[model samples]
Target: MKKTARIAAVGVIATLALTACGSREDDGDKKGSSSNSDSTSSSAPTDASSPTEAAEQYPDFKACMVSDSGGFDDKSFNQTSHDGLVNAVDKYGMQTAEVESNDPSQFKDNIQAMVDQGCNSITTVGFLLADDTLASAKKHKDIDYSIVDFAYFDDKGNNTAPANLKGLTFNTAQPSFLAGYLAAAKTKSGVVGTFGGLNIPTVTIFMDGFVQGVDYYNEENGTDVQVLGWDRDKKDGSFTNDFESTTKGQNVAEELITQGADIIFPVAGPAGLGGLQAAKDNGAWGIWVDTDGCVSAAEYCDILLTSVMKGMDVAVEQGIADAAGGTFSNEPYSGTLDNGGVALAPYGPNADIDSDLSAKIDDLKQQIIDGTITVETP
Candidate 1:
């Protein structure tokens, strides 16, 4: 289901203040507690198993999840991953639990709480929880563990995770490249910008692809469209340093706007919402990350040009299903354009791209899928 929570205009500043101070309620305090029950109802099966039969088949199995600081309401990866857990519960009639970490310090405890609850499978959201998830998986060799946006390999590209742990990662650059091209095509001021919550690979991957896309557009159309934030070569650019404050996001976006950026892309979870608000105030277009902004944050649909999406929900659900059916493996799952794992959302109603530009984008997508185009991450 699409999230309906909206940030009130009057509460914007106040909400940012609370998030910055980490004053939000700790939903993770309710450890080991089931948050949902079986809600599926279907007729008895004839040959193949029905929904009711599937639920009965896994009556003793339990799946759980732990969210990063953004929690499940960020309308980004956290919420999308949690949705996958919910989908698994509905399909298998399995018990489920979740913990929301409000700070990095809570990661270890929140994951341990899932282990203590006798969870057969656990999915931890965000790259920040990698270490804690790995340690937990090592200690509990029988429990299946998966982490989103992170992998277990080192710089040398070797497998370093335990056999019970799996990585759910996405090559978001493929679609972000498309977003960059779209921004270049629609920009009236000939400048676009992008910012991240932190300087981590998960965040910079989006910025890298965006800048490259703009560069490709310039080469193709002989247009000198400039990218205000992020320099792909030096691998340095604008960042909020944290993923919780909208105020900071707005301030950075405003700086980009002052420099003549007509379009903005913010890859900073809930903090990105602040950037969108700034775009609305300044009459600039925005490209959302992680989930479709029109569906997850419909409040900003009027200003959103599109979204670079990651299929976290589908990956998480598949992970849980594997564990429930005793087919769990530690193999890493990488989402890419070729696999329908990452994609560019449909243009918003306000987007005024012509048929020619749309067709070009479609062709670019096919090229990426067929290996004719390679979207590299810096």
Candidate 2:
């Protein structure tokens, strides 16, 4: 998934908290027990030979998860990952558990705690767990582990892939491209903007795709719409480097607005809230990321254009299911627009967005999916 630096850092913070603190919950806290594992009621198919049925192979296996700095209900990354694990539990007849840590030192302890609880497969969400995940994987060779939005490594072996561990990522560029196209079409000032929490590849992927989308629109429609905030080719983009600071996001949005950008896309986590606020103040609209920005940032809901969605929820569900069936692979799984795992959110008030423009964008999406058009990733 395309993660804003703020969200990524929170995951690490949570890991630290878990390892440093004795226990995530308070003393005598016994609420950390399995909630439910009723398989018959799930959406999973019943045929034993079916692809979904393979998850039943490990009926006795227990699945566990660890959330980074953000709580499970962070309305973004953590919630989506948790939903996937919940689906896996109901489908595979497996027990489920989770630990929420807000500090950085808690990662190793969280992984170890799940193993100690007899969990067959454990998942660590967020890039913050890279070091801790590798350590946990090496210390407990018998346990299968999966880390989302992060890769594990060993000094002597291939850092890209490791046995007994799997990595999950999404082709975030595709959806961001769509978002850029929409932003360009919707801009009244002929200028659109975007910003993020960091400058890493995960974040740049979104910026790169967005820049390409604008170029596509200009080339195809013969329109000279301009992009503000970030320049993918020149590798210059606005970033807060902190997800929690709304002030930083607001400043970036204000600058873009001053430069005539009437539409903005903020890829920051909670910090995006500031961008949303700035859009309102500037009488513009903003595109949200990860989750439905309108819903998460309800205060600025009306100013939202749409969202660039990455189907992390579905990917997580599939990953846990694979582990339950003893079919987990170290291979990284990629969620793309074609798989319904990622896409642009439905247009909001801008739904009536010039039918011709919409049709052209849709055709472009298909061409990109069919490999007729390429959306490059940097």
Candidate 3:
């Protein structure tokens, strides 16, 4: 079942506040004590086994989570990861703790706090925390670590994972390709666009797939549907370089709209809200990333066409369960279309998703999963 429990972050001055003071909520203050874990109820997990089953395999476990700058409330991947952590807590009745980082600078401190609290497994959300997570895992090999939207690439460029670390990543390009195609087909202006929080691999990967999808749509229909904000071959575009500013998102969205793009996808967490505001102002459509935009950024539901979903919540929860169950592997958990790790969100009741185009997208998704289609990323 698709897991769902939404929260998020937004704005610029708030960014400054986060950097100065992190939001630390001790959910596990009385972990071993009887508490309600019944709040978790959502879609079926991609895996056959649930957290309850996984917990049954372990003797004792304590799971803790560290969020990126957006905090657990960013209403994107961070929120999804938080949900997973809570699910494991409720499903397994395990001890749990959580730390929310307001800025990148606090990643190490938040993680260290969790470790000090005696957490055997730590799940760090977001690609930004990769280096810190890797360093922590290496220093404390006994503790299991899982990171979302990131896989380690050592200095020597070896294809190896640490003994106690699980890097949870997704082949988002495959499903993003589908989203791009949908945008291309649905756009009234014959142009669509996408931008990112930073020029990092995690953000650009989505842009890459989006451009490729648009290219595929053009090829299939023999129509000229232009994409802005990214050049797949050149691998370049407008980047806010920060995940905290809606103003920047608004600026980026306006720029793309000015370039004739009627559909815009902003891959910048809370900062993407700026783009949504711009979309509403300009009377354009948007494609949200990470979660169901209709829910996370519900204020702009009328403008959201769909979302490119990366199931970080399930991946994180599963990794913790595996570690607790003594079945943890250094092998990274890769989210893919075939594994239900990633996919495109439904065009909400407000958006227009026609029957023919919808069917085509469905076929394209299966084709990508079946290996008939391959989406490459840099």
Candidate 4:
């Protein structure tokens, strides 16, 4: 039987560092886990998770997840990735574990802790974890690993998936273009805006597609609906600097709204909630990312327009299930429209979108899927 140890919240990086050091030796010698330590008031996991679930159910397969600095309750991207692992926990009745990195520096140590705890397979969330996940995968060849939003490439840029590691990627630009078009068509103000958590490829990809969508709308309708916060040709735009601060999110959205943007899209993960709040406070409609905001961030549902879906739940669930069934492979999985890996969420039921516009949106989706339209991302 696997022992299930309860974990309190892990609040700070310093405390987690100490715990990692103190628990190091014993960690490698143990087969069980210390679950759910949310030590910080600010970094706390909003909902408590079962420290360990039915370890005895799948003795040979133990799964784990390591979150980026944003933690699991970001209510958007990271949460979607984590949900996949939780799905496996419920469906396969496997022993599961998770560690939320309160800081970037803690990523490696957190991964080490999961390995020490004997996680057979581990999934690291977001592009920020790519390098650390690669290093760990190299060091621990016996365990399987997967990364979300990053592809494995050598220093020379050759596509590669190191031994025992898989890369989960998405062509989200495909669907985000659809969203951009929607915003352009629906904007009562002639301007819309988008901002990211950082300027990484994964974050900027959405921005690229959005601006292009707006541009496409202009060419098609001869209207000058402008985009704020991003300039695709320059590959530069607005970034919140971090994924965890709602204040920064609110500030950015407030700034863009003040600049006459009535439709807002925030890709800042947890911090994006600040934008959701700002949109509500300032009379702007919001477009969500990763998961459906109306479902994940139900508090802001009434003001949500739609979401550029990443299908993280579907992808992560598939990865874990593949590992559990002994068919795990390191081949990269790219979520594209053809395979339902990426999509645009439907407009809210009570939204002002008329039947004709809705029909047009539907037509655009088919065009993209059929390759009549191509969405590009940097």
**Can you give the lDDT of residue 12 in candidate 4?**
14
Model 2 steric clash total: 15
Full ranking by lDDT: 1, 4, 3, 2
TM-score for model 2?
0.77
Q: Which scores better on lDDT, 1 or 4?
A: 1
Clashing pairs in 3: 1-43, 1-44, 1-45, 2-43, 7-73, 7-75, 8-73, 8-74, 8-75, 9-74
How would you encode candidate 1's per-residue C-alpha lDDT over 1-378 as one tens digit per residue? 322222111000000000100111332322221122221222211111123334455767888888888766677767777777766776787776666677888788778877877889999999999999999999999999999999888799887888899999999999999999999999999999999999999999999899888989999999999998798888889999988899999999999999999899999998998999999999999999987676677778778888888888889989999998989898899988888788887776577667788889989988888999898994
Scanning candidate 3 in windows of ten residues, the lowest lDDT window is 12-21
Q: What is the lDDT of residue 85 in candidate 2?
A: 71
Best candidate, lDDT-wise? 1
Task: Quote each prediction's TM-score.
Answer: 0.86, 0.77, 0.83, 0.85
Candidate 4 lDDT (Cα, 0 to 1): 0.76
C-alpha lDDT score of every prediction, in listed order: 0.79, 0.67, 0.74, 0.76
Model 2 spans > 4 angstroms off:
1-60, 103-105, 151-159, 294-300
Off by over 4 Å in 4: 1-57, 154-158
Error of 4 at 175 (Å): 1.2
Off by over 4 Å in 3: 1-60, 153-158
